[model samples]
Target: MSHEIEIHADGTAAFVSANTPGWHRLGVVAPGPMTVPEALKLGQLADWNVRMEPLVAAVAGSKCLECSKPLGDKHDDMCVTGDHEGQDDSRIVDEHDTTHAVEVPNNRAVVRTHPVTGLPEVLSVGGLDYTPISNEEMGQTLQAILDQSGAIVDTAGSLRGGLDTFITARLPKGIMVGGADPVELNLAGFNYFRPGKSSEFLITPVRVVCANTQAAALYNFRSRYTVRHSPNAPQRIIEAREALKITFDYRDAFADEAEKMIKAELTIKEFERLCREIWPAPDPEANSAVKDRDDALTGTLMQIFKGETNENIKGKKTRGTHWSGYQTVVEYLDHHAPVRGEDADSGRIRAERALVGKARDTKELAFNLFQVA
Candidate 1:
C-alpha cells in the first residue's frame, strides 16, 4: 500500500493510504488530538479544493502583494517590513500632497500546487497576526488571556475549549461590530454551565484534533492554571465537541450518493463506534440534555449579543437566531474585527488572535487551511 503521511503544525498527522488496490482509498485518521476547528477544516478540505491555503487564512496577509514580502511569522507579531509591503493601513508620505499613493496592497496570499507531487500546497506567504511573543512573555498571564479568548473556539475532540469563548475579550473593551459593549454582551462565565454550582467534576485537558467547547476553553484556561486535569475527567468540552462531530459526520457521510466509489455498507456497529468516539453519553436519561437555555440579557453582555447579527455569515444570519445566552456572547466580540477602515479598495482586515464573533465587513471568511495543488 502506497501511503503519504503529513504532519500538521498542531502535532496531528494525516495519513493517506490505499486499500483494495490503488483505486480504493481507506482511512483518514487523525491520530492525535487537535482543535475541533482543525479537524472540521481538514475533513472538509479532504475532497474539496487541494489549492486553498489555510495557513494564509490563519494570518490576514502574511505575503505582500506589492513587494512580495513573506507575510506570516510567529503569532506574537508578524510584519511585512519594507514599508508594510503596501499592506493595508499603510501610508505614503507626500511633501506637497502630490498624490503620494502607496497602493494599499490586497493582502491576499498566493495559492500554489506542490511543485513535486503535482498536488496543491496552499502556501500562506504572509498571514501572520499580531506580534511574536518571547518565551518569557508567553509565560505571562496576558498570553494566557489571548489563548483562552479566541473568536470562535475550535470543536475537535483534542481540546476542551474553542475560540468562540475568548475572541472578543482578547482585545480592548471598546472594539466590536456596530460599536457594541463587552459587558453588555454578557459572556463572563461558562456556557450551559454555572461552574462550581454543578456537580464534582474533573477533566483532562487535551488539545485534540476534535475538541469540545469546554476542552476548547480549558486549552486556554490551562495557560493561567497550574496542575492540569486528567483525560479521564468528565469533560463537558468533549461532550459538546462530540455532539457536533456526530452532526458533521452525519451530514457529510450522507452528502451525495452518486459522487463516490463504493465502500457502501456502513454498519450499525461502525456508526455506533463513531458516535461513541465522538461524544460521551449524557446520563441518557437526563431531561436537561435536550433543553435549550433561555439567554435573556440584562447585564453588560446582553447589549453586544443583540448586535452580532447586524451582519451575516455564510447566510446563517447569526443576528436573527436570537439564541439568547449563546448569542449574547457573540455580540460582545463582533466589534473587535481587525479592520483597517473604509477607502480600503480591498475589503480585507487582519483576523485578530482572539475569537472572531463577526467577520461581516472583511473581504472573505478565512478558511483554516491552505490548499496546495
Candidate 2:
C-alpha cells in the first residue's frame, strides 16, 4: 500500500497507510504563508545527510583493491611459507619460508574480504543519515499550511532545475487601498537544492486589477525568511513564522507606497535621467568598447520607456508614471536580459540572479526618486 499524508482538523500533519492502524503524527503544522521548503522542514518532511563511500584493501596476493589486479612480483615476495614443526610435515609450505598464510583482519577496514578470493571489497558507509522530503510530501506540507493560514495556492511549479520548486499563495482577503486598486497579498515560497543557500518564503503585494507585482523596499528584509537544510532546520522554520506573520501587518503601508508610485508622473527629461541612472552610460574617459556597451544598455532602457519593448504597459495612468518605468526595467531584466551559460539550466540561474539584482537596484532608484517628489 502507498503512504499518504493526512491533515487533521487541528492543523496537525500525519503519514498514514492502509497497513497502519492509526496516523503517525509528523508535527503540528506551522501557521504559514511559508515557502515550500520551509513548510516541508517545519512539518518534518525533509532532511539532509553527508554521504560517504567506503575504502577497502586485499588481504593477500598484492592485488590492487581498486582495479583487482596483481601488483607484479612485489606482492608475491611478501607471501611466506607456514612452518608446522611437530604437528604436520605434510602441510604444504614453500621452501625456506616459515610464516603461516592466513587472512589478517584489519580493524580499520569497514568491509570484510571475500572468503574464497581473499579480496576486500568497498562498501557504502552511511553518515549523517537524513530522509529527504519527496515532492508528494512537499505538496502535503503546502496544503497543510494553506488550510491553517486560510490561504490558497495561486501558482505552484518546478523551477529551472527540477530539484528546486516554488509556490505562490494568495492570503485571506480584506486587504484594501484607497485611490488605487485593492491590494492582493501573496506569499511566495522557493525551495532550492544548494546547502547554505537554503529556501526562502517572501511576501509580495500585488495590485489586484493590474496584477503588477510590487517589491517591499524597506520592508523586504522583514518580509522574507530563509532556513538552511541542516539538523536544526525544523526549529528554525518554526521560529521564523512569528516574524513572517508580522509582514502581513505591513500590507496597508506597502499598498500606500505603490499607489504613490502609480500616481507619480514622469516627464521625458526625468524619465531619461532615471533610465541613465538605472543603467548608466559608461564614463567618457573609458575605452570605446565600454562606451559602446553602455550605449546599448541606454538604448534598451529608452525603448522600454517608449513602450517599444515587449513588456505590456496597459492603462493610461500607468503609462507615464514612475511605476510603469520601474516595471519596464524589471520586465526587461526578468525576461529579456542577456545571460551567459553552457546549458539552459545554468543560463536560467544566471538570468534569475541578474533579474533579482536589477530589480533591487530599480526599486532603490524609485525610492530615492520618489522621496524628493
Candidate 3:
C-alpha cells in the first residue's frame, strides 16, 4: 500500500499509512545514526511519498540521481537536457521530453525505464534519501537550548518562502552589567540545497536596548555555532548546545569587556590612525583601479565619522574615543557592505557574517593599538 508524509505548519511531520489509515509521527533521527533506508523503514513509510510543506519546499531542488549532482532550481519546470537522446526507441520516455515522445510528470526528470514494468520512471534531484533537517526538529532544538539555559522565548517565526527561520529568547534576568539591559539570544536556521552548501543552524547575540545584532565572536566568549546536516548531525546539535552553554557561562565577562570598550577613550588622531590601520590605503605601486577602490572605502569611513551613516550612535558621547571609532566601523560594515545576491535571505546572511568578521578584526586592532585594555 502507498503511504504519504504529512507536514504540519508547526514544523512537525507524520507518515500516513494508506492501508491502515493512521498517522504515525516520524521521530528525530540523528545524522549518521541511520541510513535513509533505515529511517524510511523506521518511519514505516518506506515507499511513502514524502511531502514537505511550505516550510521546506526549497528542499525540492533537482539533484541528479545517477551522477549525484547537486540540486538545481527547486521551481525549474523543464529539464535542461534530454536524459535519453539516442537511446533505443523501445525504452520508455518522459512525456515532458518532446524529443523522446513519452508521458511523464512535469515536475520530475526521467531516470530510466523500470526494469520489470518497462515504464518510464522519474525522480527528484535530491533522490529519496536527501531528507532535510525538518522545521519541527529545528524548533525543538531551539526550545531545548532555551530551557537548558533558563532563557524565555521572546519571539519565534519562519521567514517568507520558508527558506529560513529563527527563534529569539531573553536570557535570564539579573545578569546585567551596570545599567545595561538584559541580553537576547537568537538562533536561526536555513535550508539551501545547492552544491557546497547544506542546511545550517546559527546563533547570534543582540543588545536588548539598541536591538543591534552582531555575529557572536570568540572574544565575546561566544563563537557562532553552525550545525550541518550530515550523518553525524545529531551529535553536532548536541555540540552546539554545549558550546552555547559555555558562551552563557562567560556572559558576565563578555558584558564587562563590552562595557570597557564602550568607556575607553581615543583622540581624534588616534581614531584616524585606527581607521587607517583597519582599512589601509592602496600601496604606491598599486594600479589606479585598486587605488580608487581604497579611496572609496576610506570615504565610507569618513562618512561614518561625520555621522552621515544610518548607524545610530546618538546617545554615545563623541569624545573621539575608541568607542566612537569602533561604532563607526561597525555601522559601516553592518549597514553599508555591498551584497552580491538578489535573494534577501542569502544577502542577510552574507551581511551578518561580514559585520561580525569586520567587528572582530577591528576589536583585535584596538587591543593591539592600546585603545582597549
Candidate 4:
C-alpha cells in the first residue's frame, strides 16, 4: 500500500519509525529509539514554516473602478492586462479585459513552503477558524511531555501529503498481562484538518503481537486529550501537558482490564456468540456477495481464536480465555482481515484503516464486547 505518507517529489518521505520499517517502508528507519529532535530531522518533519494566507480570486474589473485613477504614469486602469489578441468589437477594449484581485470572504489557505526549494504547497483550505500549526510547533508541544516523562519517540511522520502529522513515543514502563503478554505504553500526538478532527494526544503501549498492534493501540484506547485548531490552539496545546498526569491512570486501567480478561475464561460457544454479535446475521434479502463476505469473516475470526489461523494464539497461552477472544478479534482486524480489491499496496491501506478508519471502531467494539462477555 502507498500508505499516503507524503513521498515528496524529490523521493524522500516525511516519516521515521524505530527498529522496524513502516508498512510501505519508504521513510527513515532508526536502528534503535529516537529523541524528538532526532525523529523530526530524520523524518524530514522540521521547518515546514506552515502558515495561513488570505484566499483571493480574480474578477473582471471596471475602468470606473479605483475612481478611474491612473496606475503609475501609464494613465491606465491598474487591473488592465494590456493588449487584446482580437478586438472584433469596439466595446471589447483592452481595458475591458481587465481583472482584479478580490478577497474571498471567511476563507483561508494553509500553506507550507519547502525549506530548500522555496516552493509553497497548500496543505488545506478552510474558513476563519482554521489555524495552521507549524511542524516546529508540533515538535515543541510533544517535546515537553517527553522531556518530563523521559519517554523516547518511536514513530514520527506525516500522512495525506502532510495534511496530517504525528509523533509517537514509547514510555519507560510497560504492563505485563497475566505476567506474560507485554503491553507497552506510548504517547501519540496528532495535528490534522477538518471541523471535528482536532489535534489530539493519546496513550498506547500495546505490545503488538500482530503486524499492526501499534495502530491497534490507537484503535483500542480511550484515554486521550484533544484541542481544536483555533486562535488559541498553541496555548491550549501547551496547557495539554497537564493531562499527562493521567498516563499512570491509563496504564493502570489497561493493566487491570487485561488482567480481568485473562482471568475470565471463555468457552467455544461464548466465542461464537461474541463473533455473531460483532458480525451479525445478514438480512434474508441481502445479496449473495454480502453473505459470502460475512461467512468468510466469521470463519476467519473463529480460526484466529482457536489457533487454526496463522496468528497462532496457542503460543500466547491466551487460549480458552476472554483475553484470548479479545486479542483474536484485534489480531484479525489488524492482520488477517481481507481488504476488498486487494493489491500489493493493501497492507498500507489496512494500516491506514486500523489507525484512522472504521476498523478502529470495530476493534474497539470487539474489546468492549469481550470485556462484558
Best by lDDT: 4
Q: Give the C-alpha lDDT of model 2.
A: 0.49
Give the TM-scores of the predictions, in the order they appear.
0.16, 0.55, 0.55, 0.82
RMSD in angstroms, all models? Answer: 24.5, 12.7, 14.4, 4.7
**Residue 366 displacement (Å), model 3:** 7.5
Candidate 3 Cα lDDT to native = 0.47
* lDDT tens per residue, model 4, 1-373: 2577877778888889999897576888999978888898888777788778888887765542433533322324333433334743223333444457889999887788763467887777877887866666767878888887778888898888778889988777777777666777668888785445788876655664543544233224464578778899888887776666545556666667777887788998989898888888899899999999888888887778888442323365567788789878877777878887558677776766666667776776777787732
User: Candidate 1: deviation at residue 124, Å?
Assistant: 15
Q: After superposition, how far is residue 97 of candidate 3 from its true place, in Å?
A: 10
- What TM-score does candidate 3 get on C-alpha atoms? 0.55
Candidate 4 lDDT at 153 equals 89
Q: Mind giving the per-residue lDDT tens digits that candidate 2 earns over 146-172?
A: 565677654444332233555567777
Residue 347's lDDT within candidate 1 is 24
- TM-score preference between candidates 2 and 3, better one: 2
Question: Cα miss at 166, model 1 (Å)?
Answer: 22
| Candidate 3 stretches greater than 4 Å from native | 1-131, 150-183, 191-195, 208-210, 220-222, 306-318, 340-371
Ordered by lDDT, highest first, the candidates read: 4, 2, 3, 1
Compared with the true structure, all predictions reach lDDT values of 0.25, 0.49, 0.47, 0.72
